[model samples]
Target chain A: MKRLRTFIALAAVPLVLAGCGDLSNSSMSTNSGSSKSGSTQLTGQSTDSDYEGVIQSGHYQVSKSRGVTNTQDSGNTYNLKSFENGMLNVSKKVFSTKKYVFQEGQYLSSTTVQNWLDRKSKSNTTGLNPTDNGSKSASKRNPIYIQALEEQDYMTQKNNKLSLGGVTIGIAVNSVDYYKKTQYGATYETKITQAAGEAYAKKAANTVLKRLRQKSALKNVPIVIAVYRQASNDSLVGGNFLAYSTNKAGSTSVSKWTPLNVKNYTFPLSSGQSSPNSNDASSFSNFKSQVENFFPNLSGVTAQAQYDGKSLAGMHVNITTQFYSQTEIISFTQYLQTTAQKYLPSGVPIDITVSSTDGIQSFLSRTKNEKKFTSHVFNSY
Target chain B: MKRLRTFIALAAVPLVLAGCGDLSNSSMSTNSGSSKSGSTQLTGQSTDSDYEGVIQSGHYQVSKSRGVTNTQDSGNTYNLKSFENGMLNVSKKVFSTKKYVFQEGQYLSSTTVQNWLDRKSKSNTTGLNPTDNGSKSASKRNPIYIQALEEQDYMTQKNNKLSLGGVTIGIAVNSVDYYKKTQYGATYETKITQAAGEAYAKKAANTVLKRLRQKSALKNVPIVIAVYRQASNDSLVGGNFLAYSTNKAGSTSVSKWTPLNVKNYTFPLSSGQSSPNSNDASSFSNFKSQVENFFPNLSGVTAQAQYDGKSLAGMHVNITTQFYSQTEIISFTQYLQTTAQKYLPSGVPIDITVSSTDGIQSFLSRTKNEKKFTSHVFNSY
Candidate 1:
């Protein structure tokens, strides 16, 4: 009967874990690592019991207890918490829950981060030392994981050990939600004004810090909360809200947050749109590969991400091909748009130019919209 | 070994029958109806022996005897002939073979005509009177089959009794062949002057008549040899020479050929293209279905075939839908072109107009060419 109960819990794990898009079974396999003495460790015990208000802020709720992280051992006990802040009225809202572990690298692949988290969890649960697991070194476990959430809680888990020395919290306040009434259906408005939304974000960050101080195991971890904000709904990731972190001394130093930027982040486009330094080539390589797979006739693809120096403005793609048929050109362009939307920062303009055989050229431009939106096409043969 | 040989032949029958595209075993099952007391009957013997040169004209060869029409029955000895007229210089040439049978209906569906042939062959082989079989009537057996030949000698078989009372031949001269040389590849020049090609078509028609007269069975059958000439390579079917029949007097009267266009069959297009009274709504219904299948969102379709007083000229299609994407417009238009090309006359222009939502209009016009040709697109949005 207990074995059957374990099977049922395992079957329901995926559904519970799906709330956060990252905690996939294949990626979150707990790493068997050697343990070291003198470090405080905690293990999560999945429970069928629901716990509310574990992590709650303003209009957000992140700590919904789901039995996905449960183990076969019934004697184990685990504490979980989730916090959110966003919409007050509406059927939909965006809540981001961040689990900061001291790790290396500004940006780490999800698999790597999940490996670290797995190692950390395995070490605590099995009483095994991570150093004993020769597959990965301890130095690789000290990195930051930043996730952007919208419409749904798309948080996923990656495992790595927190540095015994300390923990750094990277805080990013994403897009703000607004209400709009339409005949078709009610929809959420994107970032309206940062000044109006920043107050909520700052208070949420402070609440997170206060909650962390209450935890005995995390009371001394150095906190680095870097807040990010979107200028408008259509803008991609917003500019940084001046980098601020807790002093090396202890959690007591997390009292004050300061702006890290020399000036307010803003880069204006010729079209009068503004954003941050969004031209991250490495970030868009995967998207380019997807485009190439869709259109094999493309001899070459050159893509540049647009930024206002504070947020992502849009993306521009120039392609060279031998195809001269207008239908083929249009089909290829639309396919590129469809694929880009899946991997790019939402609400940014996607501009593409196709140069084909016989000096034929075509341009397709589209952007996310509000008061006035226009999609334009230009062709020369 | 005998069973194996029979199995092998049956296995290969489908492969051999696929060249003409319409002679599927399932659809061509002969229906037997009551047989009348007296008619000059000749049975076909599906023999392993191949007899060549039954029909020959100019450099084109349609008389390449295939043993598929041979019979195993010794009493059955059906004589077949096919005369072709085209070119010998180019790698690709259009050759047309017309088999005039003493029957009813100037126009008959290919499948119906094939069923009659299959019935005639089966009756001759099994010695079963068609009337005794109670499947089809004698009236169904008396229809003339006209087949257009192109790249290859795409001709099958048919049989009927020659009316001893008298013979009438329907002559329709199809599109003429033109030639042009370009860097990409050599393309045919369209009809430039009918006078130059009509002489050749007339000679070819005389050759066919001469061949028919030489046959003992067909000697009494009145022959109508059509001579068609195209204005341009893109023209569907060409101008008709005329209808001529054997004199009621005898075979001696078959010498003179006359023009059948007493009123000059003229159906002028809005764009000034002249054609015959060609409103084949039923023939293009299947093609319309294909179009609808290609574009599910299509609201309506309008298609018309343009026929020269004698043969087909081209086709025009107008479509209405609520398409907002340019890719959809191109895909639908391309599908239309591909489907139309399979049924419409070669080299003829296909003009399509698509009316989409938001008052957007797309026009695609294309014509087959030799070396280098251009397709044009005009959009009003």
Candidate 2:
């Protein structure tokens, strides 16, 4: 059984105020990073629960700083989105969505973030990166350690007016820094070790926390801070959050940290390459083979695994095929589910998406706590 | 059987060039208008089909004029998204995703869109709306007829190059023009009749088409134009696409028009009002009651139905409850599915989303061509 966590109500607003306007971006950002704006629409009279309240709608507001920070931070969209959403989930651990409403980071201005993203220079003392050594060589160059910073605010409605109740900051560090030695020259990259990324993020998080306290409005606001190791520029999947720490209201510094110890791996490592996780890899291999062997017209099968330390936490699989008949889709889904239960790791939440040349045909998932699988098949209109 | 439309293979691009970078927007656009960017992600080696090819991903580039046009077109996000996406779907129907790649409008400059969105005056003769009347009275004031205009371009890849194959124009006409007769005074809205909105849109689409042909690059490109009826400022659900027309290549005029005849209705009308859709409404009412009577902790049930003329085309239902047990969720989902299959109209694609205070618990859906429902229960992490 999972241990229960305490949720403090903090403060509640009187009368349900109609939500504000929403903005949807049909941005063709990469697959992992794409998200739709808006709270799920509910008839004004729908029933509510504490867990549901935490899922309340906060107007989607992009920081004025977004255009610059995101573009310059990582060339990969999946990394950008993963860094953002992963950080937000960490914040929810402490802020308790039911107690506080969400708002885009408002106090931090765009220029401030721009300054913090740069390498230290005489004119830009606020730069979070180490000062440049002027070396073009990869070994000597001060690798761009920090990629981007994001802030999200949690608000409490008191006396019918909303005020900041807490703040969460996400510091994204580089996994690999790609650079050009000369103008329009051949680009080179320096891979950043995990230890190096973690160290830089920790220091940066601390520096940001201390500076945030300088502002009177934030001195007493509870804050959650997290660090994310971004995916490599050429990676197919996104990065993961390393860890998080919380600074309770009236506390100025974050003390104890909780290591997320999460890692994401794409199934069937590129040809000839072996994963350190051979055990889990073989389990996935067995499952993949069973599905493909049973279905001859299979085009390909791919999976992404989320691991918590050495334990498999979650799995997302994508199965592409050539079948069109509804009967075939149903039969294939049932086979895939049973095969997955038999060959894949148990207890880990698993999700499967089945599609053909006609777009998505069906979906199936088994949650962490559930033994039986739930399935959904998409049909033509 | 649906009539088969001929898909002219205009041009084919060779070799799958790896896609460009992606950006995900977590914009919280309102309930009706939210959209995610990017073509759905597929494994590198997925099988392909013709209908599926039409769903190809083009980089989601927003028009440079988006900031100004969308914000001003409708203060409501739902209207903004509806106008943008509804127009895209119409374009897809003509351009056929199998042959043409989608792109955000790039040809029209922001300044040009601004000028066209303005009312006709001595300085801006190209203005699509009538010149403003000086009178502030409701009867004398020239209501702003055109809310916003959106352009989309379809491209065909040939020998590694992408070229414009077709273009689509969307004209959002006002359903209700809310104007301040004076600054900071009482705000009143003038209801725009359906006939009025349709007339202005048809005329405006023609004018824009003729002007677009002036550009050398567009002279021979096929064009599709759609006119949308925007939802009123106070409406809970969004408005619909009134009609569309196609202007074939080498043609300067749009000769034929097709009325979409699409309307969206929110089920379980507010007290004292009767739905013109009493036939479909009672079906939903019966389904709601059976589930509610069986499970007493029901908070509320709401639905949205799409009608093609008078026949129900699709239905989406949201069931809010207070149940918790995994067994209860599975059982309730089972019962709900059985009840829905019996009470709701068959042959119409229907989708149901069930959520508790704990968030989404399960989902059930039936495609138009499929009689039996496919379901998935979303268990917790």
Instruction: Name the lDDT value of residue B24 in candidate 1.
Output: 34
Instruction: Name the docking class for model 2.
Output: incorrect
lDDT of 2 by residue, B57-106 (tens): 21113354545456433455456545654665677678775566555577
In model 2, where do residues sit more than 4 Å from their true spots? A1-313, A316-381, B1-60, B72-77, B121-125, B182-184, B269-278, B293-295, B323-330, B356-361
TM-score, one value per model: 0.23, 0.48
- Please give, as one word, the docking class of candidate 1: incorrect
TM-score of chain B of each: 0.31, 0.76
The stretch of ten residues in a row with the least summed lDDT in candidate 2 chain A is A1-10
Cα lDDT computed for each candidate against the true fold: 0.32, 0.64
Candidates, DockQ: 0.01, 0.02
Clashes of 1: 69
